[model samples]
Target: MVALRNLLTALFLPVKLCLFVFHHRVGRVRAARAAGDRGAISIELALAVIVLVGIAVAVLAVVMRLANTVKGKVPTDPVVTAAP
Candidate 1:
């Protein structure tokens, strides 16, 4: 039981740290946002998501263009072979 607990703790150490950090940062942002504007975090998050999605779309477009270009350069016609 002790070994299992230790193993679980070790495995989750990074996750715990990440959650802690995320919580701390969000708390600070919430406090800051509370002073003047409400829903500021939501607006910021929405904008960030939009920007990230746009970036993802651009990257996907470039990848698809390259893939199509490469595919066009490859020979795809079946070869005729004389059977012996």
Candidate 2:
């Protein structure tokens, strides 16, 4: 049983080593690819657009509120009455 176990271990060692090396190399390759500067501009542009949109929304909200307040304060009648 011990010899059989040894034989099995010897047979599997090379396969395990190959798998480990392949996985490590593939992981390194993926990491390098991900760390590269590809698509950086697109990401930056998306972020900028998001920020600008947020600012625009805030400005529009403020303007709308101000407009509503001003509209409420304006009078419909323009005729001035003279005091007797």
Structural similarity to truth (TM-score) of each candidate: 0.49, 0.45
For every candidate, C-alpha RMSD to the true structure in Å: 10.0, 26.9
Q: List the residue pairs that clash in candidate 1.
A: none
Off by over 4 Å in 1: 1-37, 76-84
Instruction: List model 1 lDDT by residue over 2-57, tens digit each.
Output: 99999999989967966785686578678868786657766766676687679769
- lDDT digits (tens) for residues 16-55 of candidate 2: 8667855765565566568884465456546756876797
Clashes of 1: 0
When summed lDDT is taken over every stretch of 10 residues in candidate 2, the lowest stretch is 37-46
Give candidate 2's TM-score. Answer: 0.45
Highest TM-score, which number?
Answer: 1
Pairs that clash in candidate 2? none
